[model samples]
Target: MLSPEDVQKVATLARLKLSTEELQQVSRQLDGILDYVAVLNEVDVSNVEPMAHVADVANAFREDEVRASLPREESLSNAPKTDGKYFLVPQILETA
Candidate 1:
């Protein structure tokens, strides 16, 4: 069970301002949460192995293979604006 003072102290550490009513409300809520945790602590899981996931998972990647590249003119044909060899984009940053 968490006392009102304990709740108040936690609120202070978290930089929260609580009225008297709010402090009491939070204290009750904290006590209930602690009670639930205590119930969980009574469960026996000594035989269970720790698992990272509930379902089996595997990497699903396609085999890599080299392929012919698109010609520069064909690739740049649809660009709104481009240099002969590269895409021409608006400058968005300034250097000090």
Candidate 2:
């Protein structure tokens, strides 16, 4: 069972602000979750094979191929702001 203090600690780590009532409720919920996990821990899996995924999944990625790209003028045509040679974006940093 999770104590209120334990819930508070977890909330603090997660940077969550919970009221007293919420803390109590979350404590009970966490306790229940832990209890369910404990029950699952008791299941026999010694004969089961370990696997990354339940389904037989395989990567279906195509091989990368070199290709010509769109011209610079055409590429910059969709930009909200550009200086003909480059995309013009807001200056985010200032020299100290």
Candidate 3:
């Protein structure tokens, strides 16, 4: 349980400006959330095993195979700008 003053302190740290009504509302909401978390903590799981995933899963791999690629000349021929073997771009750095 958090006091109203504690909620105010949290609001101040967050740089949030809340009215008196909003402060009260937020304080109640925060307390409710804390209470719900406390209930969750009361659950017994001593015999339960932790699992990495909820559903059964396995790696689906495909057979490795060689494939042909588009010709380099055809790939770069439509470029707005190119530097022979690669694409060219405007300078990113500013001159001093």
Which regions in candidate 2 have their CA more than 4 angstroms from the true location? 46-96
Which portions of model 1 show Cα errors greater than 4 Å? 44-96
Q: Per-residue lDDT tens digits of candidate 2, residues 5-88?
A: 888999999999999999998888888888878987778998888788767769878879988999999999999999998999
Residue pairs with colliding backbones in model 2 are none
Q: What's the true lDDT of residue 93 in model 1? A: 94
What lDDT tens digits, residue by residue, belong to model 1 across residues 1-96? 777778889999999999999999889888888887788777798998988777776776876998789999999999999987899998879877
**2 or 3, greater by TM-score:** 2
Per-residue alpha-carbon lDDT of model 3 for 1-96, expressed as tens digits?
Answer: 788899999999999999999999999999998988888687898998988787766777888898888788888999999976988899999999
Residue 94, candidate 1: alpha-carbon lDDT: 86
- Candidate 2's C-alpha lDDT? 0.89
**Pairs clashing in candidate 3?**
none
For each candidate, give its TM-score against the true structure.
0.43, 0.46, 0.42
Choose the strongest candidate by TM-score: 2
Whole-model lDDT, model 3: 0.90
